[model samples]
Target: MCNRRRRVDLIEPSVVGTRNVLNACLKAKAKRVVVVSSIGAVIVNPNWPKDQAMDEECWSDRDSCKTTKNYYCLGKTIAESEAFEYAKRGELDIVTVCPSIVIGTMLQPTINSSSLLLLTMLKENFVDSMHVYHDSFTEVDDCEKLSSEKLQDLGWKYRPLEESIVDSVMNYEERGLLLKK
Candidate 1:
């Protein structure tokens, strides 16, 4: 029988991961750690202010994640939250970066979920599901615009989205991640 991903699977492991990693970091007397979270932890908030742009301060509402059945978002929300809560003890300086649908070069041999979604769109023009996106950021065709202000503030620079797309396609082809027709 084929197994399926479940909310419990996502949420429980994230909670455990945070516990184990933090414990190890504390035990080793690590001075700092940078957690790479996703924009799912921000935009999944159903109660997001309509006119306000999403920023680092925004967090996905837990109830909203649960209601929308966005298990990844739920997991990220809990994991990042638990990590930050533990970091608040001042024992370690834990910084975090919450990136949005990253449409750029893949560093690893395997394409990431964000790149996979884009490739799927090109091939099938379909997606399994999407989170409760703020209406203002919704686009039926083109990729929606998201504010990367916080990341920018941290000196994170990015190539143009169009350039990134072209580069990703080329990279995918080189890596043979794209299905041959």
Candidate 2:
């Protein structure tokens, strides 16, 4: 039988959770284990370079994240540390994947705070309004490719950001909310 588990954000408590699960899998003598992490674990850039081609090697600096940079990023670093520790124990066959900002449709009518913020920023011209990424933005296709790399590191392809925005807007429209003109 195959089993699966998921923990999205790498919070401090997740260390314990990950350990518990991995330990169980080991005790159960599971065949495979896969862990989903974030690229932020390696790439801790507050202002992630838009032009640079980021890959798996880059890691975000946890110490810097602790020093008023961003809490979410710090959590990711801590979580990643826990994951590495688990993998080091050699108790489970673990594959870790790190992805950038994940954007898309909300499964529910009300979206999460982060997703809502991203949706608002993208659809309402607020990104342009705030000048946040006036120069560049990450597309969903690219994000999906990154996600694919995180899990499999292959067979994932890139798509333009505009296409992602269009898809997201259309998704929201299905819920009777017009995101953009």
Number of backbone clashes in candidate 1: 0
Checking candidate 2 for backbone clashes, the offending pairs are: 42-58, 42-59, 42-60, 43-59, 43-60, 44-60, 139-161
Candidate 2 Cα misplacement greater than 4 A, ranges = 1-10, 13-30, 45-54, 107-110, 126-153, 176-181
Task: Give a tens-digit lDDT track for model 2, residues 51-84.
Answer: 5555555557766766654556666667666766
Model 1 worst lDDT run, 10 consecutive residues: 128-137
Best by lDDT: 1
True-structure RMSD, every candidate: 7.0, 9.4
Task: For model 1, state the Cα shift of residue 44 in Å.
Answer: 2.2
lDDT of 1 by residue, 64-125 (tens): 87777888888888888888888787767887777767776788777678888777764454
